[model samples]
Target: MEPLFRLEGVVVAEADGRRRIDGLSATIESGERLAVLGPSGAGKSTLLFLLNRLLDPTAGSIFFRGRPLQAYDPRELRRSVVLVPQRATAVSGTVADNVCLGRRIHRLPCPREAVAEMLAAFGLDTGLIDRDARALSGGELARVALARAVLLAPEVLLLDEATASLDPPSAEGVLRALFAGLSARGEGERTVVWVTHDWALARRLASRMWWLERGRLSRPPEGADEAGAEGETRGTAAGEGGARR
Candidate 1:
């Protein structure tokens, strides 16, 4: 499969010589659900930010579909590869309004069937559509964000600690919905790059793992029980997180 994204010796640093990402190189293929793992402040977010073009590398280059990232129009690049941040912001509007924000931004007509299907796919009631977004629970907010993002059908979805703010059951629900959505999308139809600290999450959702520590990326050590990876790319074993997520 062709690489959806390729990073070559990329470096992202602060003005004071603090490097958030250092000499990183990797290839993310189409349809690959990559779980980025690491301790706190390990540059996972920074890497995702770069992938989403929120920040450019200080050196080296990043390529999308073999073309330089900067070569693509920023608005166009972002549409195909979108980032859903950790803290989702719900505009002061109805759930339908929030969910359809993408189509609005793109100036497309509102497809009501599409909206309802997405809401159901994410385990949300269609009745919630008329409800206020800010009044939704944490779990509801997370699902709303996923519903919003997936509706766009991005080729690559960059999730930066997306479900981190939810409770265990809510997080699991979100993961399961995500996996189901990917499966329904068919292989190579969509790619997901999720930054998570949960080993169980990685074990369930990722066929390949990219562990980041100290601003560098590498595969996890051999014999580590990244369970269920060989069977399915769907996250299951929902356990409470122990380490800092």
Candidate 2:
């Protein structure tokens, strides 16, 4: 079977000649859970943007399901490849409206029951459904954004520091609900590419891992201590204040 996404010598560079992503080449298979790990400014977020057509590479090619990524309409491509950005965003409306945004975009039915179920799954009280979206906290907004994307049932889900705002226990609960919802969709129906500095969370969620550094893909240092590496990545994440290229 053809891979869901394939990149060949992909390069994303700024106008001033700094490369955000350089010579990245990889295949994302269907149903694979991929964890992308990197220090601050490692281009992890840039890679996700490219995959969903939010940003195109300055060089090389990207193919999705045997077709060049650019060949597909940007809106159409985005419907299949959804991205939950590092910063949570909410439309100006009620919580239910935000949760049903994807379906509305696709012109699908926005069933009230579905919205309630998704919110509940994300550990949100259904009573918040009618509440103003603008009043949500950072963590609440993150979960809402996640629920919005998941409700779309996109073929691929791209997450960039998605759970960063939540405490560990809350993050874990959200992840559990996320996987359960995805699993209910049936095996091989959805793929997840998660960008995270939390190594332990990545281990729990991903089937494979990729590391990026200085705008290029690379292996971890030889015999790197897992626990120490996790701490280092977490510390860097904090120092950088979640800023990424």
Candidate 3:
């Protein structure tokens, strides 16, 4: 199957004028669950930003479906490749209002029945649809974001620590629903690249892992001591007690 997204020699600079990502290149196959594990300040978030077109590379290029990303319109790029951020800041609106915001913005047709079903599938009460966005809890806000993103039917899904704030049960429920709904399309029609510091979560969801350290990419053995004593495999964060600079 053809790659859905390709990054070649992609580099990004930090606020202090430092090159955080130095010449990184990778191919993202359609419908593959790829986990990017890295320490704080390892450019993991920056990489996701680049993939979502929230941030452009200082150098190098990205291709979507064999076409250069630069050739595509930014608005269109976002419509096709959406990012569901970790922090849940609900847009000011009702539950159903927020859920269908994407479709409204893009002028896409959406079914009300489908919207209600998605809300229920995400463990949200249908009555909550009439409630204000700010009234929802962190987990509820997270579900709303996921539902909205999925409703857009994006070709590629970029999850940046998306489940970080949710309680264990809520997080697991959301993750299960995500994979069950999307992964059934096989490994060649959709794509998921989730960035997280949680190794256990990565192992549970990602089929392949890429480790990042100090702006460089590493494929350290899954359970190698190099990943530190997190006791979890794959992209678990190294210094959980503190953030990296």
Candidate 4:
């Protein structure tokens, strides 16, 4: 399959000479759900930021559909490859207003109808439409953020700790909605790269899994349980901050 998103030798470094991502390379095909597993500081969030073009790599390049990302307008890139951050700060408006913000910025036509459909698809009630965006609970805010991102009809979705703040049930609910929405889209129309520390959730959702440590990315080690035993073990080491993610 052709890759929807590709990173080649990407690296991100700070002014203090600390490298957050080091020579990382990966490819994600359309419709693929990839789980990025690593200990805290494994550069997982940085990777998402890079995908969203929120961070420019100090070295190497990123390509979207065989075109260098640098060639695309940042606003256009983000509209096509939406990132739902771990903790989103809701804009001061009704939930519906915030969700429709994307189409407004893009000047996309018929935003109201599209926003309503998205809320329904995400299992959110219409009542939330009138609710204040900033007043929602953490989980509620997450749902709104996700709904807003989906409104963009992104080709690639970058999720950095998407469900981290949600309780288990709520998180599961959100995942179900996400998968269902993806299925409803045209074949090969979307790709998801979700970064999370939760091994169990990864096993349940990911079509493939990758592990990161010390700013490097690798496939799951040979003989490691494909169903998350490795993720749990890695979690312990991850607690020590070796990954500096």
Q: Estimated TM-score per prediction? A: 0.85, 0.89, 0.85, 0.84
Model 2 misplacement above 4 A: 186-188, 222-245
Q: Per-residue alpha-carbon lDDT of model 2 for 1-245, expressed as tens digits?
A: 88899999999999999999999888888876777887899899999999999999999999999999989999888988999999998899999999999889999888899899999999999999999999999999999999999888888899999999999878878976886686675345678888988777666656667888877878656544264343123223311122111
Best lDDT among the predictions, by candidate number = 2
Ranking by TM-score: 2, 1, 3, 4
Q: Where is model 4 more than 4 Å wrong at Cα? A: 110-113, 185-187, 219-245
The true-versus-predicted C-alpha distance at residue 64 of model 1, in Å, is: 0.4
lDDT of 1 at 157: 88
On the 0 to 100 scale, the lDDT of residue 100 in model 4 is 78
Q: After superposition, how far is residue 45 of candidate 3 from its true place, in Å?
A: 1.2
Give the alpha carbon lDDT tens digit for every residue of 1-245 in model 4: 55777899988999998889999887777766778888788888998889878989999999888888888999989988888888966878888888877767899763566677878876678767888888888777777788877766778888888778787767867876876665565445567888887767766667666788767875455644454344323322311122112
Clashing pairs in 2: none
Error of 2 at 24 (Å): 0.6
Q: Ten consecutive residues with minimal summed lDDT in candidate 2? A: 236-245
Worst 10 residues of 4 by lDDT: 236-245
- Candidate 3 achieves a global lDDT of 0.76
1 or 2: which has the higher lDDT? 2
Error of 3 at 22 (Å): 1.6
Stronger candidate by lDDT (1 vs 4): 1
lDDT per residue as tens, model 1, 89-111: 79989999999887678776668
* Candidate 4 global TM-score: 0.84
